[model samples]
Target: MAKSKVYFTNLRASFGRNLLQKLEKLIKEAGIGNIDFQNKYAAIKIHFGEPGNLAFLRPNYAKVVADVVKELGGKPFLTDCNTLYVGRRKNALDHLDTAYENGFSPFSTGCHVLIGDGLKGTDETLVPIDGDYVKEAKIGAAIMDADVFISLTHFKGHEATGFGGCLKNIGMGCGSRAGKMEMHSSGKPHVNQQLCVGCGSCQKDCAHSAITITDRKASIDHSKCVGCGRCIGRCPVDAVEAASDEANDILNCKIAEYTWAVVKDRPCFHISLVVDVSPNCDCHSENDLPIVPDVGMFASFDPIALDQACADAVNAQPSVPGSILDERERCHHDHFTDTHPDTNWESCLEHGVKLGLGTREYELITIQ
Candidate 1:
């Protein structure tokens, strides 16, 4: 395969053009205009920053994307699936509230915010992929419904997948509750007795009657549990711990397969902002100091090459002083691996290539 073109622009703004203008220019130069967006529903996938985390992409950036989509004659909306953990965005209601609270309001972004998985994180579209890891990918129904898919990612580190880039935003970000359960775990979930408050929320939400509360503790009967991941979202105290036994490499492969399910039958575009550069995913309520200085913005029609280019750009930068990457042993020589020794982010990009998502080799086209 030929090297895909990945367009880039450093974050340097002047009187004539600002960062938002630069972003609009970057995507257009990257060939976003090539996609026919006329009279189509475009889903602009993004993370709305866990309430207290300041590292998420600002609403202004989303507005730029939305405005561009509208100028192309498409209806655009900001979207993301409910997270699979106990947080502000675990359900649609809470998710929207958090989005509004964290500067992702429709008024702010010039587009409506739609929680991808719907009310309870159960609305999904099952797409058959039949990969080595996943047989079928369960993506959020609303995300799959869009005529065009665009990822506006805040490139950053993650404890599980090393760095959360375009593929991570689309794959794991698009998965519904059960979908996320499929990718993260290989077995039935269990309860964390220590965190159980016996609220009966899980028991009431379980469709298979698999959870029972006794002596102020909830227990799961794995035989009856279908692993729908409903309890994990419903539990008020986060006692229903997901069984995340899948190896990181398998997890990455599953993520790639899930991404394939999302973008396969649609016109897709990707943009990643290497700003804030947090040490973990924006899912965390709080963000740590950036491991590296703000790199800039990247855009590509090829998600795999987009991710690869972003990773390479980040690796080329010098580490920030008094940050996690700086404090780590730095033995891996690769910033991502040095910061997250247990994670191999390349697994996702490699699997993406095998799945025909895009090539890792990219021609970096730097623009003003």
Candidate 2:
């Protein structure tokens, strides 16, 4: 009910201290050391930029967090779940390859990278949280096994959720394959006949015999199909796609509930870097120019407050020249809405508040 404290620091440096050192100072000042990290398995959730997308947070920043966790005697690991889309990171092996390719290795980050959902994207631990929408959340087993959870987010804009921040990183990013399917769609995946080569990959992978190949084309029997999302991942030709039919508002709320499933009964912390400010998710293989100038770095015990502060800071900045925000008509005073007219990002934070995640009101304390 009271205002949460969100700590901040701008991107400035002197000879004696650099940005990494500043990040170390910022998190400690924000009370990361207050958690009992001794001998605990800590999971620092992050997005290792999809192969070609260069806007993701660099591994150097992750090293700072890992070093601090080690200093406190905790076992720390960088983690993220397998994505649902057909990409380089759809399964554990490929996901690790992408992470290493993006320069995130135990050698670079001072820790290991764990694909939260395991090799097939089906390894999950279901947490029961009876909410208005989701009854149970399927999260990656490794993520849920951690005694402590921390979100190290690359704050940026998204076409669906409006902005990807702490909650998005923890909620949607932690979901296993089925969890992502549930959040993104109300129905099972369907085949695009034009794209299907009828390789019978989906047919062979379907555990329920829902997929059939006829005349070099595939069709799914929805009645027999369970939305486990295996066929979407197994398709070699990218012919299968999840039906993104959920309303953006409903999707936002589901993300909040999934976040609750992840952080409940666990010690958690959050940090967001409002740099790059990419106009779309890092899931894309490419990143556009930043829509706004870099704001700063933020840390907080409250994920809701951290997200709200980051959004407010971004909204206050002037739009970057030639970026999407600058090119838009600016009809909506809110930058996120003006850039993505159909999405309502406020729905996530409001639902987070209603679900007792954290308070939106915050006191922004600047750390020089």
Candidate 3:
């Protein structure tokens, strides 16, 4: 197989040029213009960052991608699916508000914002993947509706999957609310008796009628629960939680499969910014100190290769003082594994490669 090519450009900029100018140059080098974007609906999949997270890609970067798509006559929109966890982005309305509050408004990015899942996060299209762990993936409707897909990822650490890269961004980030539930757990949510308010919110939102309120507490009939995860967001007190961490790993594997469902037939391009290197996922509203110095920006036609390259780059750099890595006596040689010892990021990439999503091997081309 031909090795995928990953292009890179460091943060250094000439007085006449800025990072945005360099981003455009990098995209052209990656051949993103080859896609037939004329008169097509282009979806620039991105994380707008939870309101307090400072590590997310700046809106200026999104503008560069949006502008390129529009110049190709494509109707570009910045998009991301609703979250499964109980947070500000749990639904479309609140998700949009969070996006705008973070400066990702249509006015800023030269495009509109559409929560991939609809009003309730259940608005999705089931895509069959025939994978080992997942047969079908529930993807957000708006994401599946687009003619083209582009990922703008903020490369960072993840507690479960080792690292958050292009695949994590597309696979985990693109799942609809129900799909996210499928990706994060093995079973339906369980009500913390102590936290349940007996408000019947879970029962009201459950389409399966699996939840019941009695004695001022919520109980779930596991057999009747479809594991839809709707109740996770509906609980007023955040009483509902997934089965366990084992289930979260299963959820991660399923997320990889779901990501395959999204990018399988699309002309895709990926860009990962290796700056603001947080120790946790961008899903967190608050970001911490970076673990390493700003490296550079990378673009690739292969998602897996791009991710692997980014991880390798981070691993090669010396750890930052007073950061998460500094707290440990011995630095972990593997970037993702060092941060998330239990997570095996390679598994996700290997599965992605086996699924023909992209290659793990690539030729890293430095643009600077």
**Lowest lDDT block of 10, candidate 1:** 233-242
Candidate 3 residue spans exceeding 4 A from truth: 247-252
Provide the TM-score for each candidate, comma-separated: 0.96, 0.96, 0.95
Worst 10 residues of 2 by lDDT: 229-238
Which residue ranges in model 2 land beyond 4 Å of their true spot?
none
Q: Candidate 1 regions off by >4 Å?
A: 194-201, 213-217
Each model's lDDT comes to: 0.93, 0.95, 0.86
Residue pairs with clashing backbones, model 1: none
State the TM-score for model 1: 0.96
Clashes of 3: 2
| Candidate 2 lDDT over residue span 1-368, tens digit each | 99999999999899998999999999999999999999999999999989899999999999999999999999999999999888899988999999999999999999999999999788899999999999999999999999999999999999999999898999999999989999999999999999999999989998999999999999999999989888887888889999989999999999999999999999999999999999999999999999999988999999999999999999999999999999999988888988899988999999999999998999999999
Candidate 3 residue 230 C-alpha distance from true site, Å: 2.3
Model 3 earns a TM-score of 0.95
Candidate 2 accuracy as TM-score: 0.96
Q: What is the lDDT of residue 46 in candidate 3?
A: 94
Mind giving the per-residue lDDT tens digits that candidate 1 earns over 1-368? 99999999999999999999999999999988999999999999999989889889999999999999999999999999987777888899999999999888878889999999998888999899999888888999999999999999999998889999999999999999989988899997899999999989999988898989999889999999988888888887778878888889989999999999999988999999999999899998899999999999999999999999999989999999999999889888789899899999999999999999999999999999
The Cα error of candidate 1 at residue 217, in Å, is 4.6
Candidates sorted on TM-score, descending: 2, 1, 3
